[model samples]
Target: MKATEVLADAYERIAEVVHDAVEGLSAEELNARIDPKANSITWLVWHLTRVQDDHVAEASGLERVWTAQDWFTRFALPLPAAATGYGHTPRQVGTVLVESGELLLGYFDAVHEQSTGFIRGLTATDLERVVDAGWDPPVTLGVRLVSVLADDLQHAGQAAFVRGALQRR
Candidate 1:
């Protein structure tokens, strides 16, 4: 498989894990913040979904989905000026309790669909193009894609921990 294809597959795998972890959680369970330092499952899901949306927009050279819609507001988090950072803390804002699992699932599903679609359209030459964030060193699209996929996977593992914690409670 090509580089972009691998990234898409990686995202799908992570999504499946996260999806399973949140499957049986009620609203309260989804928002359970066992450790303040670590984000709850709700926060992890929102943050990861936003990243996927932002990355797809960046890769396609289009406007970010979050900017077009009140995604942060919908999640009841403080909307950042741009998609540069995490949208909001689900645990702090208590929006997760207000949002049903179905709604959150729909948002995540949309992010995944858009990201996969963008990745599938990328050529190897496109992946080689560099994105200059101007903070650190410039990173190629392929590298950023891999990093984002890895981040999502890490958060999925965290989500599993959140689920286990909820089950125990």
Candidate 2:
């Protein structure tokens, strides 16, 4: 399969994992922190989605679904519009609470859809284009996309583990 198609499939699988992680969990369960320093399921889901939205939008030169669709307003988070949960302290992680699993899933779904669309429109040449210059070796679109996918998958797994912990509790 082509590079874009591979990315689309990977993203779709990540979306499924994310959905399952939060599925049927209450806000209380999602917001539950097993340890004082651990990130909550709500925060994990939100952060993962936010990172995907931010990175993909930057690569695509499109507005993030968060601001484009006013998800920040819906979330009513205390942080600024630019917060993507990177480098969040324990205190900052605790602040990410949602009313319900549906709300988190809604944002995830929207962001995933936008990301999938962007991936679908990408060609081999587009994937080969350099998108970041901070690193010694500038990042390519494909590398950036893979990085986002890896982060999202890790967070989604963490969320699922949190859900399982809550269930056993």
Candidate 3:
């Protein structure tokens, strides 16, 4: 299969697993503390969606999808005026506001759907073109897409781990 096709397939599979992971969770369960070092299921879902939005912007040369100034503009989230910070805690990252696991997963799937469309619109030629992503070495569209996919898979594992810990509690 071609590289674009491979990326699309990988994204679809990753999204499916994410959907399964949050299947039966309630808002409280979704927001439950997994561990001091870990995030809740809701946080993982939002983080995945945000990751996709950032990746899409990088790969398509577009604007950032979910800005800190408007975190709830999409996915039916309530907008927050200031939602940016850096730290290890879920609160520091603002992952604590995710009220419902179902909503979080649904929003994530929507982002995946849109991301797949964005990916499909690209040509193989589009993939190899280099862009100034404001990084030290810069990056290609294809590289960014691959990075998004890898990050998604990695976080999916993290989400599962959180789920397992929740089960243990």
Most accurate candidate by lDDT: 2
Top TM-score model: 2
**Tens-digit lDDT track of model 3 for 12-77:** 988887877787877777777666656767767667777787668665766554553244664444
Q: RMSDs, each prediction?
A: 2.8, 0.7, 3.4
User: Model 1 off-target regions past 4 Å?
Assistant: 81-98, 133-137
- Distance from true location, Cα of 99 in model 3, Å: 2.9
Clashes (candidate 2): 0
Candidate ranking under lDDT, highest first, comes to 2, 1, 3
Candidate 2 minimal-lDDT segment of 10 residues: 127-136
Clash number for each model: 0, 0, 0
Better of 1 and 3 by lDDT: 1
The C-alpha TM-scores of every prediction are 0.83, 0.98, 0.80
For model 3, state the Cα shift of residue 168 in Å: 2.7
Model 1: per-residue lDDT, tens digit, 3-79?
76777788889779879977877877787788665577877776677777777677678666665655555655544
Write down the lDDT of every candidate, Cα atoms only.
Answer: 0.72, 0.95, 0.69
Score candidate 3 by lDDT: 0.69
TM-score-based ranking: 2, 1, 3
